[model samples]
Each structure stands twice: as structure tokens, then as C-alpha cells.
Target: MTTTPAATPPGWYPAPDGSGTSWWWDGGQWVQPPQVPAAANPTTLARLALATQILLVAGGAVAATTIAVEGYGVGVASDYLNGNDTSIALFDLYDQGTLVGSIAAIVATIATAVLWAVWQFHAAKHVAGQTRRTPGWHAGSWFIPIVCWWFPYQNISDLWRAIGRVRPTWQIAWWVLWLAGSAVSQLSSRVYLAAEDLEQLRISMWLSIVGELLTLAAVPLACLIVRGITQGIVQRAATPAHTLVA
Candidate 1:
């Protein structure tokens, strides 16, 4: 003899439309569906955002310290070139510190970038319905060509506005500092690497100093941006989908 399928039993099940509504099944037939509030847990995204900003601030400090160490090397080299007494041991120590600091800063920066991208990816997902930009764009935009500069900002600005319908003015200063600092830092590093004499080395060191300062200035702005966006997302997550701002 053939057996029949068991009944699903009387219960509420999510609607097939994915609109966050629930339909009741009364043993044998479906009942009218009602709207149910959709829930979102974005604590992980908030934590990731906070971690990324911490790394960013720490990376800035590391970069600034590295620049300072290199500046000291310039002074030591200048003294030795000018016939003043400068110990070779001291110069060697400065060189070692600069090298180590540079490596640490590079590593920290890479880690921070990765964490930041991950955070943005998840954050964008929370507002997927409200945005034209895809979640992938949130992270991938940073690695794109010329668009990297503009797209990342646009994606983030969209996220900010989509959540609370408020314009993020702080992003302006944050983006400017990030772009300028990156350009200046790259240029200064190239100049420093190409220096062939004490005068050239000193000038390059000064440029590096300026670049590091710009980067340092951007750190706080970055922290603020991350915190604001993350907080907005977390707050939105606690609200019912039906009550959310469009």
C-alpha cells in the first residue's frame, strides 16, 4: 500500500514573497498572511567597523613614527657629511628602526584595508534594497582604477543617506584627506627612495613628514565616519522593516 505525506500541522510560516510577512496554515488550508517585522542583526558589522578604524588610527601613528625615525636618519647623515662627530652605531640604529617601522606600518595598513572592505561589504548589504550600488561594489570600488576615488565615496554616501535619509557632510573632509594623503605619501616615498645626497635626503624627509601629517589628520575623520555609519546601521537594525525610512 502507498503512504500519504504527513500534514505540516497548524502554524505560521514565512510568506513566499519574501516581504517579511507570515501566513497561517490551519491544519489543511492556508490562512491570510499578515505583515511581520523583519529582523536584522548587524552587531558583527558594527564590530568590524570599529576594528577597522582602530587599525587605521594605529597605522597612522606607526607611519608618523616611521617618518620621524627617517627624519632622524637625515640629521645623522647631514652631521656626518658636514664633518661633525656622528656615531656610525647611532646611524645604524636609526636605519634599523626606520626599516622595522616601515614594514610594520605597511602590514598594519594592509590589515586595516582588508577589515574596512569586509565591513563595507556587510554594511552595504543592510541597505541593498535602497541602493543602486551592489554590495560587491562597496569593497571592490576601492581597488578599481580612477573610479576608486569617487565610487567608494559614492557608495558610502549612499549607505549613509539610505539609512537615515541624512547627508554625510563629514565624508567630504574624510575623502579629501584620504586622497591627498595617499597621493602625497606615494610621491614622497618615491622621492625619498631616489635621494642621492644629504640635501636631497633632507628635502625628501620633509615631504614624507608632510605626507604622514596629512595621513594622521585623516585618522580621526575616518574613525568618526566609521562610527557614525556603524551606529546608524545598528540602530536601523533594531527598527521594524515596515517602520523604516525609505
Candidate 2:
């Protein structure tokens, strides 16, 4: 005797390998129909997104404070050029805080990605008729080189349009700031690490300051976007799984 998988409503979902075929979900398993990957609870995704942003913001603040304590603007580099021991201590503290923050951010990001990918696939299934993009592309685009940047945005756009909104304002703002902060922050860190003189170090410090400010501005927007999307999904989930099926 075999345990029958508990039944779910019938729908068309992505092929398990994400290879672009529509499989039928037989109100149970992926027999003749396709199946969406398992997703985390909506509340869980929202909470994780919020927590990750908080950790990143706090880490960024700690980093900025360390720079401020050393002083900002011109000639500060020469001021510390004598190699004060206190400066070294400050760096040690900053390093520790940064390490913890980085770890948290990384873990949270992976979870968020997986959660969104699954949700997108499920949402696509509810669309009447054929979806513009394949369900596999919903999650797979993020991992593809170069195309990841724009493809993820495309996938997101398709997901929300299915829900009757044309992508919220908060999402656009969040993505822009996120990409900007990442670029400037990476550049600043590289400059700081490669500084060969007091002047170079000073420039790098200012860049770091700029990077922090960008990320700081981005945090709340990110939270709002996450909340909006997660809530939207939860509300949609309340209806029959394929209410919009053609």
C-alpha cells in the first residue's frame, strides 16, 4: 500500500528541472501536470527580509561610525599616518561587527531568493492561459550571468502584473538603490584596501562613507517592498489556488 500525497487543486506548474515545459499537477502530485517548488510561509519570508535589512543597516552604521571617530575630510589621513594604536583597535572592533553582519546578510539573501522564486512560480500558475515567461525562468534567471540583473526584474514584473498591479513604486526604488549601493560599496572597499598612501586612504574613506549613506537610504524602502509583495501573495493565496486559471 502507498500513502497518497494529500491533494491540492489542479494547475499548470513548471517542470521540476525548470526547463520550460508546462506540467500538470493532478490535484496531488506532478503526474500529468507540473508542480511549483515548495515555498516558505509568507510571514517567514517577510520576517527574514526585515531582519536582514536591519542587520545590514546596523553593520553599515557601525562602519560609518568607525570612520567618523577617526575624523572625516581632508588631511585626516595624515593625522592618522603616525599609526596610532587606538586606530588599530577601532579597526578591530569594526571588523568584528562587519563579519557578523556580512554572515547574516548572506544567509538572509539566499533564503529570500528561494522564497521568492517559489512564490513566483505559484503565482504564474494562477494566470489564465500561457504566461509570458516560463516558470523555470522565474527562479533560474537570478543565477544566470549578466542577464541576472534585468531578468530578475522581468520575472518580478510578470508576477505582480498577474495580480492586477503593474509593479509597485517601492519595488523600483528598492532595486535601484540596492544596485547603486552595491556598486559604490564594492568600489569603495576595494579602494580602501588598496590605499598606498594617506591621500589614497582618505579618498577611500570618503567613498566608504558615500556607500554607507546609499545603503542607509535603501533599507526602509527594501522593507516596504518586501512587506508589500509578501502581503499581496498571502492575500492572493486565500482564494482557490487557480481562481484565475483560463
Which candidate leads in lDDT? Answer: 1
lDDT, candidate 1, 1-246, per-residue tens: 111123777666664445566655555444553343342468788779878888988888897787778778777877877787654457778868877987897899889888988998888888888776898988999988998989998888888887885766777888888898888878877887898866776777677777778788889888877888888888876443342111
- Local distance difference test, per candidate? 0.76, 0.59
Query: Candidate 2's error at 86, in angstroms?
Result: 7.7
22-79 per-residue lDDT for model 2 (tens digits): 5555566554322444562345545554555565455546545534542433333444
Write out the backbone clash pairs for model 1: none
Cα-based TM-score, every candidate = 0.77, 0.57
Misplaced by over 4 Å in model 2 are: 1-78, 81-131, 239-246
What would you estimate as the lDDT of candidate 1? 0.76
